[model samples]
Target: MTTTHQERPLAVLVGVQLPGVDDVEHAADLAELGRLVQTLGFDVIATVSQRRGALAAAAVLGEGKLKELAELTGGSGVVPSGAPERKNKARARRAAESGEDDEDDALGGDDDEGDADGAGSRGARRATVVAVDHDISPSQARNLERATGAQVLDRAGVIIEIFHRHARSREAKLEVEIARLNYVAPRLRETGGGGDRQRGGIGGKGAGESALELDRRKIRDRIAELKQELAAIQREQSTRRALRQGQRRVALVGYTNAGKSSLMRALTGSEVLVADKLFATLDTTVRALHPEVRPRILISDTVGFIKKLPHDLVASFRSTLDEALEASLLLYVADASDPTFRDQLGVTRSVLSEIGASEVPSRLLLNKVDRLSEDERDALRLEFPEATLLSAKIPADVAALRESLIAHFEASMVEAELLLPYAKQSLIGEIYENARVLSEEYGDDGGRLAVRAHPAALDRLRSLLAR
Candidate 1:
């Protein structure tokens, strides 16, 4: 019963190409899992994929490959040099993957799997493993781990681990805890408490404390406490949002790790951590965009969106995402570098619609344009005529984005001609500093004042005229 995992576990990332899934979809699946393994401190040595026209219920990938992986034991629980003899032959097959292959194997008992390289040579054996496709059920993981003799992790666990690492704020940490607890609850049941055997009680108790029940109870209590604490934080967040009412707020929303924080930092000159990892940011950060015209345009850069984003995590972040909903504008950022940008766009759009933020006037921000050439940028300009394409790393691109935002003001802003009395001419000064006054001409009745303002502020000015 080994508790520690091998230092360099040989990994094979799996993705099954099923019907209705495009090639890029499957590629993203593989790429995301690779990133997840990196976060979990696992070395991905190889990849194993299959195009399953239909799933095989008995063994997910098919019986033949399942049996092959089963026999290898993924180099687990045994060392190659001390192995009995049969297990050493596969060394040549995986030579390319063994970057630092010392003769020493990480696992114990070389005799467990085999010995020598078929000619009685000696070296400890290492573990070659498999991380299977997204949506692998708990039963599926156990089945694969048993058949392949390799520990298993699905997409959700990978995502949860990334969230677990990135959550900085207390609220975010609790939200992640709640999601993790929920994720582990069903998994613990699926694995049957890791084959814990029941023991007889000294007092002749009818039922001893079962491992499964204890794990389940602990998860349930932790989830309850996390939820309670989250609720309290949500209350505080709600109040903070309420205090900023009436300002034209905009929220930058998009797929996870889609450079939202980078763009936010680029625009506001704020020190938001910009990382090259998925879900690098989990907390919401808001800043005022302009000091004049709009006076205060509160723009929030919240957590990035993701495909197959868990509903439980969504519900937990609803209070945080409410900031996006209350916003007057939505800035949808997309990774221009991703070949499947269209699909990513569709997924984010679906999430927005689900969150009830679909109706807001959203302008797409095609980010990472620095990765593209001039011709490529021009090509995308035609693809998204309405969106702004910019690279957060480039200051010039940030300036272009700012100019594009100001252009939005031109369409929504209203121009008004006002007749001000001589005594009320001082009121015009207030409007001059706060707004762009086009003209001032004295007429027979009074002085004329012409000004341009955004719709909301224009309506407020109209009300002031009545006074």
Candidate 2:
């Protein structure tokens, strides 16, 4: 068998700047999209943006803007050779006008002319994909592909692609597939004019079904099957959840690549997979918080949320997010150094509300504080008085977070005195496992124990003694 390794596809990122939107924020959004494309294993050739009063329904960008973008991609719109220097000068002028340095190269790498994927040897490189930073409609995507002669992906499409690539566990894979199919079903098209396919079966009823309709049917059926499988998984997860009902749970919820996994590892003292890419951790990882305390606390790191996260993706991943819903506390982690961290925090809250975890007790975690200046840190403190600012890499910061968590759980504990008979000596071990034994006195019967424990555990001990 011959194994073929394909080169990374080149992509051109497009963003449309609209009225009433802050230019800096828009640029940051485009920069994040470029990062997402990089995470998706694409070599971004260029990042392009256009300012317009509003988005065009046909292609988001106007004809001239689209042509300008196509020129860079070596598409049919306009060849870059005609005004290559002019284009470069124009980009420089735009950068100057924005009061920012030539930052476009920061997206991926320097723009160079060459063949892409062995399409041409010496001509201008053709981008294999055009990634729009906005969530364009399916029709818009098709229009862009037709005009640019490349595969087109809107923001949601790119994010979903990243999810599909990063998903590892069975539940993550199933949920990602369901979300991908939902996105793909609407974009399916019939290449040939063959609507006259007749079938007598109930599934292919009404005298016929077009190729597009059949494809959509298959996607719907696949989605249903995946959902059914996910339901079974959810049941298993629920049972596991029930087993740990009395234990305190802290769920880390945050924007993608905001150091949630790093914080998880820091707090749990476990070998968690940490990456700087968006959506690096898809599966929920639960670990007992290290330096384990009485009435153990479990911390779970969940799939991160993003601005404009697909509704279907959220719906598909709801079961995985039940960890947050059932959590005793939620840590709203954010990159405190990022200028847009506040907005990212808002996005996280919105997703939490959508998942019915709005009422869950939440504490803002201003993570990655080491990247911020003292002035910036002061400003963040002023903005979010309740937020805990810490760098996951700092030992003292992680220790503070750990101690804060312990304090939170400790506040909920109840002190109780229990009497055990001599035959019930085995119960002493259970108490030591689940509670902080303050005092113990040996008696003729057995032992009198004074301990502070979670109310549920205290009740359980009382019941066990009665039995």
Q: Against the true structure, what is each candidate's TM-score? A: 0.73, 0.84
Per-model C-alpha RMSD: 10.4, 7.0
Candidate 1 CA-lDDT value: 0.69
Task: Enumerate residue pairs that collide in model 2.
Answer: none
lDDT of 2 by residue, 1-467 (tens): 99998868788888877657776888788888989999988887676666654555666665666775676666675323322212245555765787743322222222222212333442565778889988877777877776788888999999999999999999999999999998998888778775656565765644577677787888888888988999999899999997677678899999999999999999989898999899999999999999887667899999999889989899989888999999999999999878888889899999999879999998999999998889989988898899999999999999999999999888889888999898888888777767789999998888998989889878877887889
Q: Please provide, for model 1 over 1-467, each residue's C-alpha lDDT reduced to its tens digit, 9 standing for 90 to 100.
A: 87995565445566666668876677777777787777666666445455544433434555544543444444232222331212233443463365523222212224222421221131343335566666676766766765666777776776777788888999989988888888888887535455455654663212555667667877787888888888998989888876555445779999877899888887777788888877878899997664234345567898877777777788777877887888878998999988877778888888778889888888888999889899999999898898788888998888787767777666776788877777666677556544577888997778877877666666655566668
List candidate 2 segments past 4 Å from native. 1-7, 78-123, 200-206, 419-433, 439-448, 459-467
Q: lDDT (0-100) at residue 299 of candidate 1?
A: 71
Candidate 2, residue 185: Cα displacement in angstroms equals: 0.7
TM-score of model number 1: 0.73
Give the clash total for candidate 2: 0
